[model samples]
Target chain A: MNIIVCVSQVPDTTTKIAVGADGKTIEKNGVKFILNPYDEYAIEEGLQLREKFGGTVTALTVGNDSSKDILRTALAMGADKAVLISDSGNSDTFGIAHSIAEYAKTVVPDLIILGRQSIDYDSFAMASMVGELLSLPSISMVSSWTINGSSITAERDIEGGKEVIEASLPCVISAQKGLNNPRYPKLPDIMKAKSKPIDAVTGASVPARVTTVSMELPQTQRRGIILNDSEHDITELVRLLHEDAKVI
Target chain B: MKIIVLLEPSGNSIKRSSLESITAARALGATSIHGFMYGGDANSAQIAGEYGLSDIAHTPATEYSSTAAATSLAQFAKSESASAIIVAANAAGKEIAPRVAVKLEAGYIPDCVGLALVNGLIQGTRPVYAGKARIAVSATTAMSVYALRPNVFTARKAENATSVNVRTFTPQLSESDTRVKVTNVIRNEGKLDVLEADIIVSGGRGLKGPENFHLVENLADKLSAAVGASRAVVDAGWRPHGEQVGQTGKTVSPNMYVACGISGAVQHLAGMSSSKVIVAINKDKEAPIFKVADYGIVGDVFDVLPVLSQKIGAVTGK
Candidate 1:
């Protein structure tokens, strides 16, 4: 089996989000970049699947030259090879997915995996778009997966409960959290990753479907108004909710 | 103007979140509201008419899937020259909206709690930083795409609605187009999941053991609320992944969110701070949850939960 996992380099989830001086875009001056956590789950799942099924796992990402560091990390995680879809700068989820899907057409892997969504942009739509662009069976919010001879089964969490679905081979799946406990890279593997081969592919020149005009911080909550000591304050609080807050 | 609202079928009926999107679309001066459904049964068209939609576009999928449905809808949106498209910010919408946005080169906004048209421009108020803050944004593109957050806008029944005009479109797709195949789906047997619940009762590390989650579950049953766990609780495996509410988990905006024995982590607060009424039951008076809570009881949850459940039961007859 040949398994291909798609990943993206995004701002670290722990990075402090700040608005630029123009108050419209995320401030990039001090932001640190890292691999999206969801992609980590995808990579780990791919590696485990490859280990069990005796196949090769290739980790793929689309970004500028700076994103090679994330690919290196994936290589250290037991992937056989890494592919970087290089671009001039960052691309929206659609552009990136389109390029990946076009590349997948040539590779024709048996299974494709990606995170349910990217943590930084959190668009959560790229995997589905890639599935649509390829006309492949797709599943989202997958918690568990098992592969049969020519079919695969996955567990998906819905609003009320879970749904068990089965599809044929050559399917695409976007994994959510808790699918598996992702393993960290060891010192030996990290050193071995230096010798791993990474191929750079130019991304597709698709017109950007959406453009972010500006990104501003959400309105901050005001400091809490402390109530004076008294049981009577409960009534005042309820009254404020009914009148001022209008949430009751 | 013609506004198309993409209605996803939930179970045997239409999701309530789609009605909220229709409400917002109407505010944008939609003369004719078109409801689009994929892999949906015949009742879906009728349900759309009940929601005040005048036209319904039905695209039955051979594969009975969301990807096929989205491809069909994207074609419909382009052919009809739709000025605006509205969808619910649920799993299906989250998957399909961006695909349509990319196909049509439309400006897409996700998790919009409210929408309005100001001076011929559509403005959306969406939550950021989990649910701690709401930011208003305007689309830079010509056609606007919006995904409405669930439970923010109440869905009202529209009386005397006319029958919908239905049309079917065959999706154009290739085998290579369908790369990511869904191999299987597993369902969990339980009560309401956190994302769909109207009220949620959540716990944290304050609970001594995983076995003690029954206490929280008991209160949840009393209020017909879903049970949720903070990251600490989830990491401990007290509950399944579906029950986790935080930055790394599912983002929820319920009507009433009750936190029991939880010390508010910034990540946890990001997921559920947008709840309409926040009630915190914690022994520590300085717990961060109290800062955002509408009502806080400083006491042991073991004692407070029983009394609170009784009070709520007496009022709600549950």
Candidate 2:
């Protein structure tokens, strides 16, 4: 059995997001980057699946030079190998999926796994698009998965409830939260990951359909009005909601 | 211009997000609004008509449950020469919209909150970074696809619009095309989903014990709101994972959000900060939630919740 997990590097969640001088892109200066938190779930799931089924877990990522750290993190997390699609050019979710699908055509993994969505853009489209591009069965927001020979069974969260779906092997799945608890790399594993082979590939073209004009922070709110007055408290609050905020 | 809105069947009726998409489609100067419904349900056709969609295209897709729906919709949109395609930002729509966009090679905007036509091109605003910022994007492609956020737009009755057209489309799907299969479905009993509720009452670690969740649920019942919990509460297993709202959990933008005993960590704030009206009830006066809240009640949640619930009940005689 062969499994591939897709990962991406993004600004750490703690970073104070700010617009660059161009006002269209994120300010990368003095910002720390890490493997997307959601993708860690995919890596862990892939490793566990490999351990149970006896297969190789290959982690893949699409980004520029800084993305190597993410691939290293995956290898450190117990993936057998890592592949990095090094293309600095901006690609939409569709383009990223196309690149991954194209790469998968070569490796032909039995299962392709990815996070439900990237934490940065949160487009939530990669896994589905990859499924469509590769013509593979795909499920999103999957909480639990079980494998029995060539057949796979999983539980997916819907709006109101969960859905039980069964599909054969060689499928694509975007893991949701609580699928499995991801483990941190031990000191020995971290040292071993440094020697693990990381294959770097390039020359992927992304069709551009949408252009981002500018990105800016939302307008700040006014200083909050503290209600120190005791007599007309709730009434003032309701009035503020109705008249001032007009939210009611 | 002909506009096509993909209607996803949510249980027995069309999803509310699809209705919002229709509202946006109409605002784009669409002369004719067509809705494509998979599985050929008559109730779905009727509901589409209520959303001002005059032409209804019904296609029965048994093998291709959700993904095939997108293929069929793309075919319909191409046949109709739709200028724009609109879809709901739900689970199915989230999967299908991008696929359709990629197949059509159209400019796709996911999770848009607002839309308008500018200089004959569709312009959309989407909240990014978990609602910390909004980005306005314009489509450079010939056809534009948009996934509108759920419950953002009210569904209005489209009077005297009864004409429905049902078209049969065979989607191209393969058995090997899907990588993941759903094996079981478990539904929670007796509470509305936090994402769908108009009013949400959420608790955090400050609530302490799992037994004390009744305090939050009791207030939620009185206010007719859904109950949610922070990541801490969910991680501690005090509440179900579905009810967890934070950066790592569900992103909710409700009309009214009530935070009880929640300290409002940045991760938690990212989920509900987009809510229209926020009310915070906490013992700590300096909790970050108060920064974004419209109303702040400085008191213990156990004390404030019951009092508020009783006062609301007495006011409404419930």
TM-score of each: 0.87, 0.93
Residue B277, candidate 1: C-alpha displacement in angstroms: 2.4
Off by over 4 Å in 2: A220-248, B62-64, B158-167, B170-185
TM-score of 2: 0.93
- Ten residues in sequence with the least summed lDDT for candidate 1 chain B: B177-186
In order, the Cα lDDT scores of the candidates are: 0.75, 0.79
- The digit string of per-residue lDDT tens for model 1 on B1-318 reads 678888777778778888777776776778777888876574765766666787777777544455556677888877788878888888778867876776666777787877877677777776654443345676667776788878887776576676877777666865443433333334455568898888899998888789888878887887788999999988887877778988788788898788888988777887887787787778888998888887777777776666666555554567
| Candidate 2 residue-pair clash tally | 17
Fnat for each model:
0.30, 0.55
